[model samples]
Every structure is written in C-alpha cells, then in structure tokens.
Target: MIKNLLLSLIFLTVLSIAVQAQEALFGAQQIISPEVHDDASVTFRLLAPKAQSVQITGDFLPTVKMETPRGTFDGPGKADLTKDDKGVWTYKSEVLKPELYNYSFIIDGFTTTDPNNPFLIRDVASATNIFIVGGGHADLFKVNDVPHGSVTRRWYDSPGLGMDRRITIYTPPGYENSKDSYPVLYLLHGAGGDEEAWINLGRTSQILDNLIAEGKAKPMIVVMPNGNVIQDGAPGEGSKGFYKPQFMVAKTMDGTYEANFKDIISFVESNYRVKADKSNRAIAGLSMGGYHSLHISNNYPNMFDYVGLFSAAIMPREDATGKIYDNFDGKLKAEMDNGYKLYWIAIGKTDFLYDANKEFRAKLDAMNMPYEYVESEGGHTWRNWRVYLTEFAPKLFNQ
Candidate 1:
C-alpha cells in the first residue's frame, strides 16, 4: 500500500509540472499593425498560443469585444481570428480612423499582448502596445530647428521625507538670453508618472514654444515636479496609483502634498531666475496632480494666484454626504474667492472624474468664486492636457 501511494504522488507531481509548463508557454499574446490613413483601410493581425476567447480593447472601443472568425467587432472595424497547423492563433481587424490609440488582448480573464507590435508604453502596472491611427503631430514628437525649450532634471534634498527628490523644469524661449525674471508655472504630474512624463510624453515644452511663437501663449517657466515622497536611502522611490496598499496607507488624497509644494517653491525661488510673487506663480496638473493642485493651493492661499485642475478628483466630502460644502466650506469661501487671480478647471465629458469636476464647479459657483471651466473632446489623456496647457497659458499674466 505504501509503494502504491508513493507512485500516485509522483504521478500527480509530474502532471502539475506539465500544467505549469503549458501556462508558462502561453505567456502574453497580442495582435500587431500600424495606424493607417483616415481614408485608407488597413488590416491588423493578432497571434495567440491556443484557441482561447480573446477581445480587442483600444481607445476606439474602451470596452472589450469578442473576437469573431470573420465579422466586424460592432464599430468602424472588425476582427477575425484563425488557427494554423502550428497551433498559433491569428486575428485580423480593419483600419478605422486616425489618432493615438492604446489596445490590448484579453485571454481567459487575463490581459495579454500582441507579440507582433513593437510599439509599447510602460505604466505603473503593465506595459501597453501602442498603434497610431494616422501619423502623430510632428511638433510634439520630433525635435525641430524652431526655438525650443529644454527639460532639465534636478535633484533636491527633502527634509520632510528625509531623502532626495527629482523634478523636471521647462524653460521657454529667450529664457537663456535675458536677465529679466519670468513667471513660473508649477505643473504636477499624475499618479504612476514621474517628473519626465510631461516633457517626454506630453511634449509640454515644444507645445509651449510653438504656441508662444504663434502669439497664442505667453512664454513662462514650466516646472514639472515629482509628487512622490521618498524615505531615507531609498532609491527611485515614487508613487504611481491608488490601487496599492502603501498608497492607500499613505493617504495620497490626504493633504500631504504640502511637502512637495514647499520643496518645489524653495528650489525654484533659490535656483532659478523666476518671478517670486503669488500673482506671477501658477499651478496646474492632471488627475492625481490635479487633486494635489486643488488641495495645495487652497491650503496655501498666498502661494499661487492662478490654479488649473485638469480632470480633478474631488474626494468624498468627509461627512459621507453628497455636499461639497461640508469639506471645503471654510477654505472655498476664504481662499478661492479672494486669493486667486484666475481659477480654471478643464475636463473631458467622458473622463471618469467629470461628475466630480462638475460638482466642484457648482460649489465654486455657489461661493461666487471667479473661475473658468472648460470641457473638451477627449478623455483622461495627454492629448487633452497638451491642449489645455496651450489654452490656459495664454490667459495667464494678462493682468
């Protein structure tokens, strides 16, 4: 009996090993193709390991759709998956429109990738493959001979967090030639992003230079700062999303951003030739950065005269009620009404935080606060933030 039991146990262990091997072989799967012209139609092909249910999700279709053998996926395009003798699955889809899109494959309840596409972007949780509908804007992605701004990375000693932190600064046209001081805009990046995001991905400096050259925007110093707190001796420490337990424990929503604000203000005032007055200083950011700007500016009423929040996340008003006045009552009345020169909020209609932005706007209206609210075409993306900065900059320093 003992011998028989040992043999059965060995057989089960071998079976487990085989199953694990099959799973590992599956890895991540995806489809590949480039963004085609708007008038031209193109096909995208995806390869998978086995016969599994796969769906295509992209900016065009924010939701997932089943992969069909030869039918359209219910939008401007369609997808078909076929299998070859080698046990590889292939899927093809027709070209739709032109725009920057993010897409992925979902297999057996897990998000996978198309092994064929070389374009990808790294986020906090996973990497996503990118496909452009048409070619991207030349000014934003490519370096040009036109006057441009430089993005510099600066490290500073943070006494509050007991570690060094980094920030990205964008100096506009004529910044180097003149001894005259310029107004500064402190731009904060969202969660899962670093100081480099606006400069690298958003093309902030280029957009500003082009806009200013066209007389559409005012030339100013744009400082993009890393909002994450680092402890002693910790290298590359940062916060990306609110899904992690540490992020929640840190109460990223809780008004701790004053530490980052103080560091940025001190660094800019001491190191750069910028106008140090509240009227000349502005603050703006996207998502988590938007939340930070709202809290920080309100808490320090005298620090910034202009404040912009793109897709701002207004948290629950602390009283578990639907009233915004309960939480921001005193500050909303005292700081935003009298202290700010221009308070602006811009958000897309499809953004997840649209409702919260609307509610906050209504609260500001009730307090008779003077501000600007703008709604545009896209969701939470750099596409919208780039345009937001272009429009918002021109309105600043006018008084």
Candidate 2:
C-alpha cells in the first residue's frame, strides 16, 4: 500500500511539471497581413505547438472567441489553431473595417505576438502589434519639398511659475526679412511631451513648410511652449519622466495654466516681431494643450481670434459663474460668433477623447456657437494633429 501511494504521488508531481512546461512554450507566434480593405478580408496566422489552444484579441475583436487551426488554416474573419502533423500551429482572422487596431494573442492563458506584422507600438511595458485597415492621411515624416519652417529653442522667465521655461518657435520661409511681421500661433504640448514635441515628434515645422510651399497653406509663425510648472529649469532640461507627477497636479489647477499662458504671451511679445493683435494671434494644442487653449482663449477672449482644440480635454460651457470666461458674460457668445475667424475642434474617430470632443461639440451647439468640428481616421497621435494643423492654418487670417 505504501509503495502504491508513493508511485501515485510521483506521477501527479511529474504531470504538474509537464503541464507548466507546456504552458510556457505553447504561446502563439506572429500575425500576417494586418491591414485589409474595408470590403475585403485577410487571414491571420500564428505559430504554436500541438494540442494547444490559440486565441486572438484586439480592439476590433476584444473577446477571445475564435480559435486558430493547428497548422496554416485559413478562414473568414476568424480561425482556430490546433497542432499539425509537423508540430506547428496556425490560424487566420477575417477582414476588418478601416481603422487602427491593437491586438495580441493568447496561448494557454499567456499573451503572445504576431511576428509577421512590422507596425508595432509601445504600450507601456508590453508591446502590441498595430494594424491599419484603410489608407491614412499624409504623414509628417513623409513630406516632400516645400519652403520649410525652422524650429528654435528659446528660454523665458516665468515669474508666476518661478521657473525658467523653454519654448520652441517655428518660423516660416522669409522670416529673416526683418521687415515682415507674421501672425503667431501659440501651440501647446500635452502631458508627457515638452516644447520640442511639436517639432520633433509632432513634426509641425515640416508640415507647415510643406503646406506653405505647395500653396496648400499660408505661412504663419508657430510658438510651442513647455507647459509644465514644477520643473526647476527649462523644459526638457530636467530628468525624463520626473515632472510627470507635478504636471498631473498642475493640469487640474486653472490658475497654474493661466500662469503658463502669461509667461508665454509675455515672451512672444518681448522677443518676436509678431502681430500682437487678436486678428493675427491664434492658440491651439492637443490633449492637455487643447484644454489649455480652450480655457486661455476663452478667459482672455481679446487675446486670440483663432482658437483651435485638437482632441480637447475640456468641454464648452456657457454657465461661467466661476470659470475663467466668467468675465466675458454675454460677450463670449457674441465674440465667438463674430470676433473669432476660426474656432476649430478636431479629433480622431478611434481616439479615446472622441466622446469628449463630441460632448464638447454638443455643448457648443447648445450655446449656438460657431465652430468647426472635424472627425478623421486616426487616434490621439501626432499623425492626426499634424494633419489638423495643415488643414487649420490656411483657413486662418483668410477672412
């Protein structure tokens, strides 16, 4: 009896070990042909060991419902994976609509990858594969020759924030003429991004230069300011990811953002030969920057005639009993209708802020305000903002 019990215990332990080993090695491998036409379908394949289950999950197909075949199986919109005679596994997914999707594979409860797709983006700690269904708008990195705009790094003193902030400005071709005074667009960067973001990551200078040269856009000055307040020195000068906590706190404070605007406006007026009037001044930004633009412009309605919010964080409200624009009173509504040539709000269809922008747009509608709301094929990325600036610039100062 003791010998039999010992033998059974050893068998169970060995089986547990084997099961763990199988779980570790039984992950799904690469995906093939991520993008497909809206009307058409594409097959996705994965590599796995025999007798293991593989499931695909993503923004399009959030649930792990479909199974992949063991070896190189093709199906419509979905597939099942099982082990083949060769000990390999594969599955194909169906055609999807035109949009950006984030997808991953699950093998025995462990998430895996699709090695076939090249377009991947970092999602915090882990990496995920991105697939685009339809064609996208013109990218900033893919710009052809147009009179290019140049970006400059400038330092400014912020008395309110008690830090020396850094700002970036984009000057169009002929800006060196000294006799020329150009309209200025004060663009703000979002959280986790600095003044350089508009030029480096956002590629605002390239987009403006290309658009201006091609006669697709009018030449204008773009000023990008570092929006954080807790940093001791200029933006991008401190430790990376260090200012994040302070930025988060400052973002919620209306006064802190107002101080940033004061510093930026003062710096522009002091340094550049810019048209300082409302007619020639504009303010725009994305995400947090969008929120800043909305509040700053509305607070000081006389400061900017063109205000743009790309994926804005704040909604439009006329009940300004305690808010920044409370001083504008009925004039806020009247000026919005007439004084501003363009009050534009743009967001991507798949962006997290799509619902926010929609709610804000509805608020504008309730107030009977005049503004332009645009929805395109993208998320909260530089691709959308670059195109937004390109399209928004020409419409400005034209009237």
Candidate 3:
C-alpha cells in the first residue's frame, strides 16, 4: 500500500539520520568495553581519544549522598577515567557487591551513558547505563536454569480514569495449565515510569522465577500497573492519550488510578484464575508507587493483607500519611492487630527518604504493630529496589 511504503521510507530516513549522528559523535571508538574480572571488579573502556577528560560515576563509587529531603542519586560519586595511549578512556572500579548498578560517563563535564553498553534503564527523566555484578548476594537477579514466568502486555478498562490502561502481568511458569487459583502481587512503578519499569530494570520476572524455582518464593502472579494516573499507559501502547498537565502530577487524582484501584483488582481477579480473598493479595512499590501502596493500604485496610514500602516517600505535610493516623492511632492499631501476613519496609542507608521511613517504622513500633525493617547499603536506585523485591517476594504467602 502507498501508506505502508511511505511509513517504511520515513522509518528508513530516521534510521539513517540516527546512524549518521552516532557515527559523527563516536566514530572508531570501541564502546562495548566492559570487562568483569573474577573478583567482581570491572574495567570499563570508552573510545574518546579526542575528549579533554572523562570520569566514571555510578552507585559503586564512594561519595557522601546528601541527606536532604529531595536528595538525588545523580551525584556525590565519581571516578576520574584515564585515557590510554590508544585513545581509549578507562576506569577500573573497586570490588563491587553482587547487584545491579546504574552509571554514566562524564565527558568534559557532560553526563552521558556508556556508548557501548546497549543495556540501559530509563528513569524518571533520564537514562543510565546498567551492569550486573554477579556472584555472592545478587544471584536472585541472575538468569538460572529455572522455569520462567511469562510476561504479557494486557489492557483493562479504567472507569475512574475514563480510559483503557495497560499492565504488565507475570504469570508463573505452569500458570497456563494449572487450574489452581494463584495469589497476586499488585506491583506499581515510580514517577516517570511505566509498567515495564519493574520487569525490565528491576528484573522482576527473573528474580521471581529464580526464587520460585529455588522454592524461596511462592509461585504466584505479579501485576505491574502503570502508576501514572493521568496517562493510560506508555508510548507505543496505543492507549496513551493526549498529554495533560494533570498527567505530570505524581498522584492524587480524584478519578485517577488510586481511585480506580479496585477496577484493576477486579479486572485481574475476574480475568485471571486468582484467589479472591484478602489474605491472597499483596501490594508493593518503589518511590511514588511506594507512597501509593502505603496510602492505598491505609485507605482500604481490608483490600490487601500484605503491604510493602520500598524507599517510601512520606510527605512532611502529613495529611493522613504514614506519619499519623487518619484521626486516632488506636484505630489503625486495632486494624493492624487483626491477622495480616506481613508489613515490610526496606530502604537503603543513603536514601533521601531514609529518615521518613525510619519515622514511619518508629510510628509502627510505637503502635506495637509488627513489621519488618530492612536497611541495606546503597541509595535510592534500582539496585536496592531489586534486592528489596527479591527479599520481599519470598516473605510473601509464607504465613
């Protein structure tokens, strides 16, 4: 067809322009230059013979992270890269722990990802090169000889948002034929992230698959929903509507996702052979999604029996947040006093919201409410979030 021919021509033209741009910027540079040694040390090489200076920055580097409320994971850490006589920039990192890390290259004060590393994670508004340090404690994120769950892109009608939104669903291996109803974990993403955030960057599917195969985790379904209330879904999904200012807002939509939480839950329960009781339901998220999980658990106590907060952001303006009770502490205490499997919170030592999470933990402790607290060494990055999920998923449905 004429239309198809025109589209193909346009694509070819764009591809040609992009290739030309890349060639102009990085001509004759050996970009894919990461060599991981047996001791977990990695040597990164970048072809930038003409650059004035280059520095490598990642979570593995040592730097003091700011303790302010809005602290970011962008800086406070960097390593000077040395350019060899061959015009290749190189930086050898210290022995890193087994985990995933996001890094970038600073070329003449400009922040850029590793040109050779094709695997990068798209964050709120930026992209970062990612590498996985294998062995030791990070085996959960690794691929193993295990039965893997399938990830499917599906849509559900959101009456509250007045649109059809997409969610990435992960049904455990054998779910297709297994007639047994399975418990579900409603996973949510952070700001500027779509449903693919967890599955791609966090490696939720691999973690779950590995854990389940090891019998460390329960074989259940994971439903990762797009947390943006204003937007129906990510680009290329065909469901995303015209951008609006409200779409930029983090949360608190009168007719947004939280308002229609039940809609997604209902659709999943109805469509999938899932267990329908509260004890069979769990919810967890990171950052903005973590805030939603906390508040949603508060607003509807009986909806989910298991709640997880990963680097949860607790606004200082306390408006029925984790800080204080809706009105009385006794009410929430009594509600929690009832049977619930687990209430877990995890955060890194350098998390900007570490103080807020500690305060929330103290509040929960003061109420004599049982909850688990995990403090790891890292910042507000996918590295910690992925570890939290690996630990959290195993703890679920155990009781």
C-alpha local distance difference test of each model: 0.67, 0.68, 0.80
Candidate 3's residue-wise lDDT over 248-335, tens digit each?
A: 4544422245656898998999899998888899999998788778767766778889999998876544333432224535546755
Compared with the true structure, what per-residue lDDT tens digits does model 2 show for residues 132-153? Answer: 5543434333445555666788
Over 4 Å off, model 1: 1-32, 38-55, 62-98, 105-118, 131-145, 177-180, 231-249, 317-327, 337-339, 377-383
From the highest TM-score down, the ranking of the candidates is 3, 1, 2
Q: What is the TM-score of each candidate against the true structure?
A: 0.71, 0.63, 0.84
Q: How many pairs of residues collide in model 1?
A: 6
Better of 1 and 3 by lDDT: 3
Q: How do the residues 1-399 of candidate 1 rate in per-residue lDDT, one tens digit apiece?
A: 999999999999999999988776563332335434455444445445575665555555533333466232322122434556654554444555544455676665577666667767654445667654444443433345678766777777766656677777888878888898889998877766667667755668777777777676677899987665432211243433234222222334445555356876888889889889999999998888887888778767888899999877676634223122235578767786567788999998766677788888888888788888899975667667766876788888877
Worst 10 residues of 3 by lDDT: 316-325
Model 1 poorest 10 in a row by lDDT: 70-79
Give the lDDT ranking, best first: 3, 2, 1
Task: Please count the clashing residue pairs in each candidate, in the order shown.
Answer: 6, 16, 0
The lDDT of model 2 is: 0.68
